[model samples]
Target: MTESATDTTPADQLGSGPGRVLVWFYGVFTVAAASRSIVQMIMDFGKAPLAYVLSAIAACVYGFITYSLVRGGEKARRAALVCCAAELLFVLVVGTWTLADASAFPDATVWSDYGMGYLFIPVVLPVLGMLWLRRAKR
Candidate 1:
């Protein structure tokens, strides 16, 4: 009745436990940011090209992190960790820049104002992601 360690699969290892929530959040952000950026770009790229581009970049980062979390391996874990750090940095820099020079960004990006528009999920998610990733590593 005992199961062998070899019987465990990657799927069982990833997108399970606490990682399940992380994956879900990342997936949601990916879709939200991507769709928002696409719509903004189509409707009025001239209004806030920088913000829209940043939104697209954030979407890409979120998508990558979501995929890595789902993949569930050492490689994917490392990639997710790195991306989480980068995401945090982007949020901080963009947030500060937006605050200091509001005119620079006619519109807001996912990271602008530390994700105030998104209820600060974009600001907080990466910190939680990095912490979760570190815990998952062990």
Candidate 2:
């Protein structure tokens, strides 16, 4: 039996496979969260300034983390780990608070209600990102 270049698996699979998936997911969230934050900030910052700012921060984190993962280097991988930690904290705290006091939001943020509006990608993405970074351990 023989395998072609397309045969990606346990061997000859090339660089960080899981990292690829994480990067893709993070890239999507980067666009989604950044767009949402920008619109919210421009539309009515006075309505939910804090939430919007957090959204932007989250967006930036997602973008940087994605970049770090794709970078495939020691420093970049470590950077991704740090970003993943921050994301996990943000999701947990914001998710809990939003579920507890939706009124405090005044408007939806990416982490609100455990990212229900974003289909919980915020919750799941960090875990995958962390796992991928760990695997990439340069």
Candidate 3:
């Protein structure tokens, strides 16, 4: 279905209310992961390449979701939903990997121990984003 130009209701806005909160969290996570990864990758990438790289990837995913939310369209909503799913999958895989084999990650990633450093927000945020996106559907 095609969306009209004047379709600017709050329900149609992915960045409204709770979606706005999602955007805030995603934006914060983007900055946090990006900066952490950039510094780690620059200073001591060889020390824990997997962790740093995973953090960088997480940053990219968070950045994309934040952008999709702010863009506020059906296409953007779908994109955000898909990214949230991927983010959750990454969190679970990485979280479990970090726990199952500590040697694999000498250092911690943003999703390490299921975002223990960040209060598990990394795992929870994506689920909330997906729900909000579904509700904001046009």
Candidate 4:
């Protein structure tokens, strides 16, 4: 059988081209956030419980987005899109909260100051992921 214009292979759908970069970034962020939170929780949980927990949550979101991108399917695409949106929301809220009240976070979460500590990747990645996922639907 011949392939139609819409008959994109798995690679063409997601986890290819820019999606590959997304996957790589997400994977790295996942590990980074997880490690930071794990170390903080073990070493000084009481010092900044909120910050550590937020970092852990960011790690989970990054992990899920990475998985969905690598999985490469319509379902996975949808899941990634939703997670990306949620991740963006969390970053905005947490970032704003951190800025508004310095005492609220004695330590920085992965998303502190709109991910300023990580060069703002935490804030930018989700927007990029959402755009890429939207294009992938085509």
Candidate 5:
């Protein structure tokens, strides 16, 4: 048996296969980061403004990547790739900053300690996302 070009269904897009898993992960992070930031800000913004703000930023990045992955196209894939790279950089910078100057954070951002609170998933996810996006390009 042979499959034709039309066999490419919607499920065969970037959001399918491994991309589906990536979307799920990104979606989870979006909610986690957003809610955590919101609660922290509401509870005591003055306590750790920098950490809360960073968490909010992480939430936005995660949300955008989630949307792009689900949207599924070359453009969306490229957008996701860029976001993933940015996410990785954010994690690295914030992680190092938090360590180098603990007083500046007061509390932990989503990327603090290299995502230690989240079992390092935040740090690893973007790397996996970039790789997946690259693979989907071909």
Candidate 6:
């Protein structure tokens, strides 16, 4: 048996590089997402179903991202990309709308304040994670 020319032998070096950054971001996101959802769900599940559901979704995505990083491969890479992209979209839309109309968001989601609660790291990390995956795929 032999390897394909398309094999990313060199790229995997990043498994220990700033890809560690991807790992860190995923870790942070996982904790943040989980905590936020847990808090909201416990405090007042009936407050906003849409927002709470989205929060739960975000937590699941974060967990997926974390798992993908720990188990890197083509499939994990794709999963991580999809998760991060969703996070980016979530943050952008939630951030803009929440700021524009404060009345609508009775409480901030994990993506609120442009992820200011997390120093906007949540907003930026996903974009970075996707870039890292693209580079690793190269």
Candidate 3 structure quality by residue, lDDT tens digits, 13-95: 88888787888999999999999999999999999999999999999999999999998877888889999999999999999
lDDT of model 4 at position 116: 99
lDDT of 4 by residue, 2-101 (tens): 8886676854558898898999999999999999999999999999999999999999999999999988888899999999999999999999999999
RMSD each, Å: 2.7, 5.6, 2.6, 2.9, 3.5, 3.2
lDDT of 5 by residue, 1-138 (tens): 898855654533777888889989999999999999999999999999999999999999999999998877778888899999999999999999988999998899999999999999999999999999888877
The residue pairs in collision within model 3 are none
The residue-by-residue lDDT of candidate 6 on 77-112, one tens digit each, is 887888889889988998898899977778778777
Model 5 local distance difference test score: 0.91
Give me the runs in candidate 2 sitting further than 4 Å from their true place: 1-15
Which model, 1 or 5, shows the larger lDDT? 1
What lDDT does each candidate get?
0.91, 0.81, 0.92, 0.94, 0.91, 0.79
Model 6 TM-score (2 dp) = 0.83
Compared with the true structure, the alpha-carbon lDDT of candidate 2 equals 0.81
Name the runs in model 6 displaced over 4 angstroms.
1-15
- Displacement of residue 95 (Cα, Å) in model 4 is 0.5
- lDDT per residue as tens, model 1, 97-127: 9999999999999999999999999989999
Q: Give the better candidate number (1 or 2) by lDDT.
A: 1
Give the per-residue lDDT of model 2 (tens digit) for 77-103: 777788898999999999999889878
Model 6 alpha-carbon miss at residue 3, Å: 9.2
Candidate number that wins on TM-score, 1 or 2: 1
Q: TM-scores of all models?
A: 0.91, 0.85, 0.93, 0.92, 0.91, 0.83
Model 4 lDDT, residue 22, Cα: 96
TM-score: model 2 vs. ground truth: 0.85
Model 4 ranges with Cα > 4 A deviation: 1-12
TM-score leader: 3
